[model samples]
Every structure is written in structure tokens, then in C-alpha cells.
Target: MKLQSVAIFVLFLSLFVSVFSDTARTGDWTPIKNLNDPFVQEIAQILLKEHEKQSDEKLSLVAVVRGESQDGAGTNYRLVLEAKDESAATNIYEAIFWDKSFTHFKNLVSFKKTYLILLFYNII
Candidate 1:
């Protein structure tokens, strides 16, 4: 009985470790081709185009949903920005916020260049 209990405890410990270990892994963001929704696809394309313009910088576009109220009126977007240098990331954030597409959410999420780089560094 003691041997069986030890095996069960070891199994549970391994499961716990596996589940928490990958929290540090960074997820890859790939562009979705031929999305059924034209609106979402258009946004993605715009973000991709902006990213392409910054070819000298290491950047990627990621789609995410933002929310605040329980009614869920926050905006969804494909954001393109640098993940390394704080200055580059800030430039990208300013450019995106200045862009007409993201004018609405500018007040919602104060896009900080340093924040994104730190976030990516932490994840990786």
C-alpha cells in the first residue's frame, strides 16, 4: 500500500510540474490566411503591411481581444510591433496609436514600448 501511494504522489507531482513549466513558453503568432470574416482579415492585412514596413526590426503581428466591461465592448486587433528594443517597440506603439485604425483604443490600453519588450522577454 505504501509503494502504491508513493507512485501516485510522484505521478501527481510530475503532472503539476508539466502543467506549470510551459507558462514561460512564448506562443508563435502566425498570420491567418483567408479568414472567413472580411473585417478581421482586413485588419490583419493592415497590421502585416505595417510590420513589413519595419523590415529592419524584429517584429510580429498578434491578434488579441481586449475587454473591460461585462458587456464586452472592447476592440479586437492584430497588433504589429517590435519585441526587442524598447525604443523600437515604443515607435511601433506610437505609430499604431496614431494610425486611424486604432484611434478608438488609444485611451483604453496605453501602449507602452518598454512594456511589450519586457513582456516578451519574460515569456521567452
Candidate 2:
């Protein structure tokens, strides 16, 4: 019947919009540079250590420094990290924020915001 066909079409349209709309609004977050600073490296090592503690598999990590701002001759940095896990991904995120090595970064709040997106999947 036409009514059934219309209902199915509506459902498919809604699903398509829901899946693709987020990607359209927010561009993909890709790594710009590998973290090379000793401090940043320390944070990464801590995260990897935590991952190893939780799971036996070797963990892979990618660090991306996205933005920098200068105010009153002071520099602030925003970094995002992508971590892989076969079991729990959220755990890796929590460990990074809680770890002390990242404390010196003046913009932890903004950094957390950028990194949090890793928890969500973006279809593009």
C-alpha cells in the first residue's frame, strides 16, 4: 500500500539524516602532528601503561596538537589523543585526563572537550 511505502521512506530518511548530519556540522578531527615534547610523551607513556594494566594486548596511540593561542605573551596548547582498545575505549580517555603529566597544560578544560569527541563516532 502507499501508506506503508510512505512510512518506510520516512524511516529511512530519518536514519540517513541522523547518521550524516553530525559529520556535516563538525568536520573530521584528524591528527596534525605527532606529540614530541617530553612532557607530552610522558603523558602518553602513562596512558599506555594504564592500557597495558587493563588489557594484555599492545595499545596504539596517536596524539594530535590542534590549536595554539597566545595571550599576554603566554602560549596555550590544545591537544587531542586517539587511542585504540579492543575492550574498553572509555577507560583510556578517563586515564588520560586523570593522569598528572597533563596538569601543566593551562587549558585542560578545552583539551578535554576536544579529546572527548574521540568517544563518539563521526560518520563522514
Candidate 3:
């Protein structure tokens, strides 16, 4: 009986440590390695749709430029996307989405236009 109690206690302690370690490393944004990942592209599409609902502008996702993810209560994805509006003029945007995978809940945290700086060279 005493041995069983000790085994249970050890199990609980190990579980606690595992959960704590996972929670401790969350909340820091990490760079996404695969820009061409289908899942990343899907997230970009989701962002465009959500943003359109709020802004009433029909935007289409052209590509997922880059992104980062931060884990916490949910995972927050920050992405730079290349997109075009109804008129088809391409533009860049920085969009953030918070998604809770377990519950399948997601929200568009923010979206705004971003600009790309272009440099030109001249040879004389």
C-alpha cells in the first residue's frame, strides 16, 4: 500500500513538471521556417477572409511572405502577406491571428497595410 502511494506521487510530480515546462516556453514568437507550407497559406487565406468581414474590402491572398508564431493560451500567428484587392493592385499587409487549436477557435487580432522599400541603382 505504501509503495503504491509513493508511485502515484511520483507520477503526479512528473506530470506537473512536464506541464510547467511547456507553459514556460510559450509566449515567445518564433520565426516560421517554411513559407511555402500549405498550412501557412491556409492561415493567410483565413486572415484575408476575416479582415474582409470587418473592413468590407474584398481581398485575395496572393502569397504568404513570412510569419512567426507565439504560443500561449492560444497560438498567435504574425504574417506578412502579398495580396490584391478587387482592383487587382498588389499590396503587402501585416496580419496577426490568434488560434486555439484544441477548441478550433480563432480570431483576427489585427491587420494593416505594410509597405516594401524599393531601391534602384543607376549606372552612368
Candidate 4:
């Protein structure tokens, strides 16, 4: 009976660890292609095209999108802008922040910058 109880306790412990560990790992950065968001995918492509045009202080683009604690409406439109350096990121941030449409949609925006933009739209 003692051996059986020990086995059952071990099984429960393993299950608990697996569930919690998976949740804890969700915030980590994943590959840019893992976004799988059509809108974000389009934006990334457009940004990549523009990035190619820069000869100096260039921006190397990677479009990575991720949400917060849950897949709720909170952070669905999150996209991270990684650039060649801080200046590149800042420049990109400025372009997005000053765009007329986004300026009008400012109320719905979670935050905006050349380096990062989390629009109101849902990613999924």
C-alpha cells in the first residue's frame, strides 16, 4: 500500500510540474515566423522591404508577435521590432507612431513606437 501511494504521489507531482512549467515558458521569445498572424505577416513583409532600402544605419528586421498572460484581447496585436541598433529601432518607432491613421486610432492603441507597436486589432 505504501509503494502504491508513493507512485501515485509521484505521478501527481510530475503532472503539476509539467502544467506549471508550460505556462511559465509561454512568455519566452519565439521565432519570427512563429507569429502566424496574417496582418502582422503583411506588416513584417512591408517593413522588410523598407529596411532593405536603407544603406546606412540599416535596420535588420525580425517580426516577432506575442501576447501576454492569456490570448485575450489585451495584447493580441503585439509585435516586437528588433533592429540593427538602438537608432534603427528608434527610427522605425517614429514612423509608426507618427502615421496619420495610427494617430487617429491612438485611443485604441496599447502603445506605439518604431521599435514596438501593439495595435488594437486582434492577432488571431
Candidate 5:
């Protein structure tokens, strides 16, 4: 019975992965311990707090910029959040971005580290 249950669980997991394979590729996000930079930390805390207050759904802030970008200057930093789907992404954007408090997200990033936040959950 134990072995049979284990096999079933594995099969289910495999099927789940296969179903969302394409999304896994483009919107792949790595879970992490933390982002060490003080500025990024500040931004993340603000976003997380707002997300929690606005919705019951839990969301994660994954990477704060993709590709080969510089650490502090020149390159723009984009904050990527891993959403369940497009609707979640849209809601997050609407609830947070449209608010006046965080309206200057990109500018705030630039001010802190001369970077930009190309934030969007998973528009694709």
C-alpha cells in the first residue's frame, strides 16, 4: 500500500509539471532565501505588505531584473513576481501600481540605484 501511494503521488506530480511546461519555461522563477541589497529589500517589503493587505492570495517577488544586467548602475532593474496566472498578475498590477503611493515604482528604483523596475507579473 505504501509503495502504491508513492507511485501515485509521483505520477500526479509529473502530470502537473507536464501541463504547465511552457509557462514554466518563460515565467520560471527561483525561490530564494532573500535579496541582500538594502534598497531592493525595502522595495520588496513595501510590495509584499501591499500585496498581503490588498488580497488574500500569497505572491512571491522573485527576481528584480532579468538578463545580463549590472549590479548598481546603467542597467534597469525589473521586479518580477510569480503569479498563478494572468488574472493574478493583472489584479496585482491594478491594486498596487494604480495606487498613488507606489505610482513611482520605476522612478524609485532609479533614485535608489539608478535602475528601473519593469514590473509585470506574467503578462504573457
Candidate 6:
């Protein structure tokens, strides 16, 4: 009877550990369900403004194509955006932004013209 109890306890402990580990893991990016959510649009706008400031390009955000976000010290957004300047055709860009709203801190991590844009240009 004692041996059976020990085995049962061990099984419960292992189960608990597996569940805890899954919950504790971080940095897994998950797709935003509502692409049209105002908050997601706001994040995309922020990325465009930051990119414009850094590059001195006057690009207006046409739309957010898609995005995923990861939770960490701040929320990290990976977005595919369509934007265009005054004289240029709409182009797709991929950008990453990290935001900590509680602290009012935000950073533009990276931005680059995506292959889709390059392929579009080549075909035209």
C-alpha cells in the first residue's frame, strides 16, 4: 500500500511540474486575433512614426497587413505594414517594436523592406 501511494504522489508531482513549466515559458509570439483592433493599429502607427523619424521619410501608414506579439519585459510587436510616401507606390515593410506602456517606454527594434515589396518592384 505504501509503495502504491508513493507512485501516485510521484505521478501528481510530475504532472504539476509539466503544467508549471508550460505556463512559465516566455517569448512565444502569438498571432493577434483581431487585426483590426484599435490597439494593434495604434502600434502600427507608432512604428511608422518612429521609422519616419529615424529615416527622415514621410511615409503614411496605409494598413497593418499582419502582426504577432510576444510578452516579455515589454510587449514586442512584429508587424507587416503597408505604407507609402508622397511620390512612391505602396510598399510592404516588416517592423518590430517593443513597448512597455506602464512605464511609457517604447522602442523601435527593427524595420526593413520585406521581400514582397522587392518582388512587386521587380515584376513591375
User: Model 2 — TM-score against the truth?
Assistant: 0.31
- How are the candidates ranked when ordered by lDDT, highest leading? 6, 3, 2, 4, 5, 1
Query: Higher lDDT: candidate 2 or 5?
Result: 2
Q: State the lDDT of candidate 1 residue by residue for 10-120, as single tens digits.
A: 999999997777443333223434344565445544554554454544444433222111112334333433333324442333122122333454222233343464354
C-alpha RMSD of candidate 4: 11.8
How many steric overlaps are in each model, in order? 0, 0, 0, 3, 0, 0
lDDT per residue for candidate 5 within 1-124, as digits (tens), equals: 9999999999999999988666423233333324456755555556555655555545555444322123232223334433232344422222112112334433323112111233332334
Give the per-residue lDDT digits (tens) of candidate 3, residues 6-104: 999999999899877644366778889898898998999999999999999999988777788998998999998879999999888889999999999
Question: What local lDDT score does residue 100 receive in model 4, on the 0 to 100 scale?
Answer: 30
lDDT (tens digit, per residue) of candidate 2 on 13-83: 99999887754232333332445767666555554655565566555565533322222323333344455
Candidate 6 per-residue lDDT over residues 1-124, each given as its tens digit = 9999999999999989987774534688887778799999998888988998999987888878778899989899998888898797888888999999999999999999887654643433
How does candidate 4 score on lDDT? 0.42
Tell me how far the alpha carbon of residue 1 in candidate 1 is from the true structure, in angstroms, after superposition.
59
The ten-residue window of minimal lDDT in model 5 covers 90-99
- Candidate rank order under TM-score: 6, 3, 2, 4, 5, 1
lDDT of 4 by residue, 1-124 (tens): 9999999999999999988774435334323345556755555544444544543334555544442221222222334454444354432232221113433432122223432243432322
Candidate 4: clashing residue pairs, number:
3
What's the distance in Å from true for residue 124, model 5?
A: 10
Is candidate 2 or 5 superior in TM-score?
Answer: 2
Write the number of the candidate with greater lDDT, choosing between 3 and 4.
3
| lDDT accuracy of residue 15 in candidate 3 | 89
The global Cα lDDT (0 to 1) of model 5 is 0.41
CA shift at 30, candidate 4, in angstroms? 4.9
lDDT of each: 0.41, 0.45, 0.85, 0.42, 0.41, 0.85
Per-model TM-score, in order, reads 0.24, 0.31, 0.72, 0.31, 0.28, 0.76
Best candidate according to TM-score = 6
